[model samples]
Target: MPWDKDASQCAQFDRVFLVLGNHEFYGISREDGLKAANALEVEPQLLGKLSVLNQSRVDINRRVTIIGCTLWSYIPKEYQLWVRMKVADLSRINDWTVENHNTEHLQDVQWLQQEIHNISLEEDRRDLIIVTHHAPSATKTVDPKHKSNPWGSAFCSDLLESQVKSWRGSKIIHHWIFGHTHWNTKFRQHGMIISSNQLGYDSRGSRAPRFFNYWFPQSGQDFVITKTAKV
Candidate 1:
């Protein structure tokens, strides 16, 4: 309930972009979290339902864009329910369950390509931030099992790297926010790519490591941004 109000406050900014956390939908099957999100969506005063939707993206603000995606590997169906519940409301949960039943894994290479192309065409005046459920870059930390790694989505990363290079020649991609690694990271690449990892489950619980880097639009803005590249 509090997070709903908190999310509402943050999502109301001129630009707010969020990458899906692995556990975003994890507690959906539980009684508490699901009830809370469900309650939030119906709040008449909040902007909980005022986001823009496309085939594979949600433009939260004119300056902020979020790309919803699927996992690369086939997680247990029960575990995958967490992801489903976060994106869809209670009314559509059943339908999403039925439609995605027996699914293998998420393959969004084609969709990502198209979405990036569309984003690239937009003028460079506005900020462009890419959001995803997994870390597409190598700077993300990993677990021994490697399943919880930030670089989990190699395909998505390849697509992003190519796109960033191609477009950087013309446009400005300011940030990439993600949440799978659940670690705090800030790093850059070739003095170009800049990224930030997730802030953990709860701000207080485990204290999900987090970093915030601000870019100023002034004469001395050409300095390189800081980032934590895993490699």
Candidate 2:
């Protein structure tokens, strides 16, 4: 696998973090996919630099903390049946039932809430960067084409209004990074930056210029995030 070879190259980095995506569960049982993700943490080639975030938190320093999970989309009650029948996740991922998916979403949400609450209570609160494979906001992240599609719920959750809005203007969260929509988006909401940098699949034989540009900011340069000083 490309990742097996790529893991060795991570030795040069001080740290590398990853969160499983829905595609990772494809062609395998959810249990097995999780096992594979967890195994990467101990891979010898990674030299302990790699950490797979699964409903977990990692403290980078006194000033920053990262919490991440593969937040599967929260399928709405009305779209539940349609999504189950129409979404490829159910058919391709072995043992992935709608019930299981919904349950996992709830668990991920609960975990995130608890982690944020605990961090907010700390005497010295650290800025948070919440990472998830699925976009956290449905209205904000959904592709325009999918906006009216019922199955669109399979791509994002309405966390922006349901939970994040209650964060009191994103006082603790510095940014949110997500990718699943395969569409690039960056916007500010409630005092926090929400963004996605996705290199979407090539259509037929050609790739979208915008996506290619975002992936190589030095060239087309749609948006760029730089580190001004060492942490």
Candidate 3:
């Protein structure tokens, strides 16, 4: 699917990284789904320009390193059963049980923590930018209307409270960009810039506002990242 004309457009860049999301596993076995997703990195049509970041890191330059993963959320215990039965992921992704989901989430969290710890020990540390498919924090990510809804737990994790809070004064990590809630937002939290810029659903009635056009101009120019912070 990554070789599709629209997706292959990413080849225009010297390097492109993709973080597989939940939907990427839909309609396939977990193992097969991962194989398919990884296939994108080697897609010949893209001239080997794409890198699928699965609990991995890539140094973009001497100053920046991006760590990326699906980073699946930790569904609240009360909502776990509801999510298992009601969410389309369980019904569609073959061999993917709620237990599997929980296991992957834990693994991803551990991998991220270890990666950060390794970086912290390095004599020359690069500015870390985490890119996750799932929202790292639930705060201001869930729709205000669904803030009290148990289902909101499916969209984001408590990484902000559980992990990021511990790095409040750390200077190694600078930004965390994520998506899943489909809410476009940018805010500073725990000494880092957290942002989500998503196209979301195409329908006019979609709850997530459609601001992709503004963020990504139709003029074919690359969007600029003007938001900066002193690390």
The top-ranked prediction according to lDDT is: 2
Choose 2 or 3, whichever is better by TM-score: 2
lDDT of 3 at 30: 75
lDDT by residue (tens digit), candidate 2, 1-231: 135767876776788888888878889989988888888789876778998999988998888888899998878789988898767899989988888888999999888887887887783367888999988987667556557878778878888877876853257887888877766777888777888766545332345465434433332123334422112
Lowest summed lDDT window (length 10), candidate 3: 215-224
Indicate the worst ten consecutive residues by lDDT in candidate 2: 222-231
* Residue 202 lDDT, candidate 2, scale 0-100: 39
Ranking by TM-score: 2, 3, 1
Per-residue lDDT tens digits of candidate 1, residues 1-231?
245545556445543333323244453432354455556545666555433211256654777555545333233435445544433322333333423422412344445555666776774555555545555554433332444433233212443454445543224445555444444445665343445444333434333233212111111222233433331
Q: Please tell me which model should have the higher lDDT, number 1 or number 2.
A: 2
Which order, best to worst by lDDT? 2, 3, 1
lDDT preference between candidates 2 and 3, better one: 2
What candidate 1 gets wrong by more than 4 Å, as runs, is 1-19, 27-43, 48-107, 122-127, 140-172, 190-192, 201-231
Candidate 2, after superposition: displacement of residue 141 in Å? 1.0
